[model samples]
Target: MTQQELQQLVEQISLEYFKRPFRHRVVINHRFKTTGGRYHLADHHLEFNPAFLTAELRTDLIGIVKHELTHYHLHLLHRGYRHQDRDFKVLLQQVGGSRFALDVGNRRPQAKKFHYICTNCGQQYHRVKRIDTRRYRCGVCSGILKITTKM
Candidate 1:
């Protein structure tokens, strides 16, 4: 949907769900990579991921809109608007907003792990960051450590 259509939908949802009129702008942010939407506390504007704008993901779009709107309304009303707040939780459930942002492959890519083994003792050690095999030795046997593999 176009940005204008999304704005109308957001305004409509605000009125229907929270009984409040949304006066701020809604933006379809193509730059959004990890989040379904974002609610700007400074401007009271809402930004949504453009990836969820398809017909197949309309429900997800609505849920994201509602989730941001929940933050919008609660913050404007000076109620607890944070995720950890009781008021935010209650209002979000009352409005049927999604509790979490829609996942958009936000999982962090795992860093390569370094696997090491002792030459004499066979004790293994796994670490995320690379370690110096020359300086570090096996903890159990104090034997020379060598690179086993990487994952």
Candidate 2:
């Protein structure tokens, strides 16, 4: 959705659920990586990940909005706005906000450690976790495997 639509949605949700007006800007921040949304304490602006607007991630979008709104409203009211606070937890539950942002697993394979290269055949291997190069060898040519990169 556009920034204007997101702002309207946040205003609507704020009034509907919290019974308070959201007098702050809501922007779609495409650069947001892991977290679904973030409420800026200094400026009181709410930022949402653009991925949340997609059809497959609508529920996550709502949940994240609620989560950020929880912080927004609480901080505005000078109440406990932190995740560890009771007020934050209670309000989040009442609003059906996600306790933690949903982990939509990394779209691309993350760089792995312990890259192994075959000595004889020049084969390459990547592993998510560390592997013992000494115990493993190249299947193609039974070549000794060497560590290429740590990550």
Candidate 3:
């Protein structure tokens, strides 16, 4: 959707749900990598991820809008606006907004993991934590395991 469309939608949702008119700006931000939307405290503008613009995720888009609106409205009124604030949580739930942003687009790669191998069967295993080689055996072959790489 165009920037104008996004602005209209944000304004509509704010008025309908929060019963408050959004006096600032709303813009689509393609650079948002992990979050669905963000509310700027400095300027009171709302930035939304463009990935949620698909027709299939219209509800998700609405939820994101409400989430950001919660921040916008609360901050404007000098109420609790941070995520940990009771007022923010209450308002977010009242609006039925998403508790978390939808994951869209490419995410950062996972941290390096431990790579182990079964000495007898050559089967490999990836684990987030280091395991005791003497106690833990290969699930497939029940063979002794050895760490091959820290990654």
- Candidate with maximal TM-score: 1
Worst ten in a row by lDDT for model 3 = 103-112
Candidate 1, residue 42: how far the Cα is off, in Å: 1.0
Candidate 3 lDDT tens digits, 1-151: 7889889998999899989999998888888889899888999999988889888888999999999999999998999999999999999999999989778755877665999999999998888889999999999989999999996
**Ranking of models by lDDT:** 3, 1, 2
Report the lDDT tens digits of candidate 2 across residue range 60-86.
Answer: 888889999999999989999999999
Residue 14 in model 1: lDDT:
91
Candidate 1 vs candidate 2: the TM-score winner is 1
Misplaced by over 4 Å in model 3 are 108-114, 118-123, 127-151
Candidate-wise lDDT, in order: 0.88, 0.87, 0.90
- TM-score to native of every candidate shown: 0.76, 0.74, 0.75
- Give residue 101's lDDT in candidate 1 (0 to 100): 64
Superposed by TM-score, candidate 3 places the C-alpha of residue 116 at a distance from the truth, in angstroms, of: 3.2
Among all windows of 10 consecutive residues in model 2, the one with the lowest summed lDDT is 105-114
Q: Rank the candidates by TM-score, best first.
A: 1, 3, 2
Candidate 1: stretches off by over 4 Å: 106-128, 131-145, 148-151
